[model samples]
Target: MYRQILVHPEDRNLQRILWRTSGDEPVKEFQLNTVTYGLSCAPYLAIQTLHQLASDEEDQFPKGAAVIRRDTYVDDILTGADTLEEARDIREQLTHLCAAAQWIEQR
Candidate 1:
């Protein structure tokens, strides 16, 4: 889920990693292009991204947007509806909402 949110280009430098294959090798720098799991800001960034997405697509997915804003926890969503029909509708809305951001939800 974190990997689905891209880091801003200017901020990618802050997520850089240095690695070496062997003791004799020079260190190589790699810039992370997405929100990584272990970074101190990862949780905030991911949740904020979801909020932004909900805001952006609210008109098209009000139910899903509400779920994102109210029920999302880190990478998980815990929500329920009063009726089976409403639950299905919410699921559809959430599926479409996530698809809008290219974030696939695995059942």
Candidate 2:
């Protein structure tokens, strides 16, 4: 999720950190220009952003919007279907829906 959502330029200052594995060298300042894994609000914010996107494009992706609103838990998406084809279709729908929402799925 590091590069999925970008950190606003003005807010990048808050995500900065000092790096120095050992005390032998001077510490260096580093800034996170994108959303990273450990931040408290990262997961929630990411999910909420998707939810908002789904809501905004409900007409274009009704099923995807429903899935985003009800089937997701944190970072996991729990969905199923009676047949394998249906399940795969749902998965594909979710994938394309995410792309249509302008979210780049990051592994």
Candidate 3:
């Protein structure tokens, strides 16, 4: 289950998501593409959409694994890092980007 949960409540965009899976199964990979519904002006929807595109952010993962990539009406985000440290770094960068209104948070 990869659901985008809004961390801090605010008029502006601020959020984080969790993706979990089970069973020892072969993960299916795909060339991902993202887009916004272009209806609601809420970060929740955008965050959810990102997960919908790619949401396998589990603990046990391969290195340099760039997971989710969501493209809004005119914006986008790329989450999922190779290592824990890389993921944290990505989160920081994403936080700032969202604050700057670049594309909003998709954690």
Candidate 4:
């Protein structure tokens, strides 16, 4: 089973840049200026980010790869796989993704 990971967006600090021309509009892109997603108080922000990433990656593999995410008071991730290898692979990827975030097993 995949680890119930708790990722924090603060691990990567956010930065805002103001670059606007006299006749140009302003656009912004969130810049992750910190580590990974495990070094802040609000861990759910990072969890949300990971959830989107997982969703995007769900179709990459044909196996039974279901990335489950629960964000109540915190972030909870449960990855479903038909085989142990697939499960373990998902867990490994999650660990790597949150290499800087705080994560532990559900049970």
Candidate 5:
């Protein structure tokens, strides 16, 4: 889930990785293009991104936006509806909302 959110170009520098395969190898620098797990700000950034997406697309996905803002926790979403039809509608809206954010849902 964190991997789905991209780190801004300007902030990517802060998420850099320095690695070496062996002791004789020189360390190489790699900048992360996506949000990484275990980072101090990862949870906040991921959740905030969801909220921002919800706010930005509220008109087109009101139920999804509400779920994002109120039912989402970290990388998980715990929500439900009174009826199967409503549940399906929410699922569809959320699917489209995620698509808009380029977040591919993993089954």
Candidate 6:
């Protein structure tokens, strides 16, 4: 999720990822190049991504950011409306908001 947020080029080296497929293989070292899961700061990084996207005025929806900040948890987005049309509209709005941030809605 941290990969979702853009990081400064200067700071990218700080997020270097070093690993190997197997013990017999030589250790490989490379920069993350993007935020990723499991880093100690990943949750904060993901929240930053959400905050940055939600704060954009051009893509703001009625109570949309509030809903995301308050309702979202562990990748689940929980929302509904009194009517199907309203629900669908919210869905579309949310989808557009994510798309604007380069996150394609999967499903």
Query: For each candidate, what is the lDDT?
Result: 0.89, 0.78, 0.40, 0.46, 0.89, 0.70
TM-score of 2: 0.74
Winner on TM-score between 2 and 6 is: 2
- Those runs of model 2 whose alpha carbons end farther than 4 Å from true positions after fitting are 21-24, 101-107
Candidate 1 clashes between residue pairs 3 or more apart in a chain or in different chains: none
- Angstrom error of the Cα, residue 73, model 4: value is 9.5
Candidates in order: C-alpha RMSD to true structure? 4.1, 3.7, 17.0, 12.9, 3.9, 4.6
lDDT of 1: 0.89
TM-score of 6: 0.72
lDDT of 3 by residue, 5-86 (tens): 2324442232222343655655544321222233354455555544433333323222211333433432354445579998
What tens digits encode model 1's per-residue C-alpha lDDT throughout 1-104?
Answer: 98888777898988889999999999999999988898788899888988998998899999999999999997799999999999999999999998888643
- What is candidate 5's lDDT per residue for 1-107, written digit by digit as tens? 99888776898888788999999999999989998889888899989999988998899999999999999998799999999999999999999998888642321
Error (Å) of candidate 1 at residue 9 is 0.4
Residue 81, candidate 5: Cα error in Å is 1.2
Q: After superposition, how far is residue 40 of candidate 4 from its true place, in Å?
A: 7.0
lDDT of 4: 0.46
Q: Write the per-residue lDDT of candidate 6 for residues 6-107, one digit (tens) a residue.
A: 666898889886899999999998886676678777777777667666777334675566666777764568987899988888787777776767642222
Candidate with the larger lDDT of 1 and 2 = 1
Model 1, residue 48: what's the lDDT?
Answer: 90
Which segments of model 3 are wrong by more than 4 Å? 1-78, 102-107
Q: Which stretches of candidate 6 lie over 4 Å from their true place?
A: 19-28, 58-60, 103-107
lDDT of 2 by residue, 1-107 (tens): 44677777899999889999999999999998888888888888788877877787778777777888999976688877899987777777777777874534332
TM-score of each: 0.89, 0.74, 0.26, 0.33, 0.89, 0.72
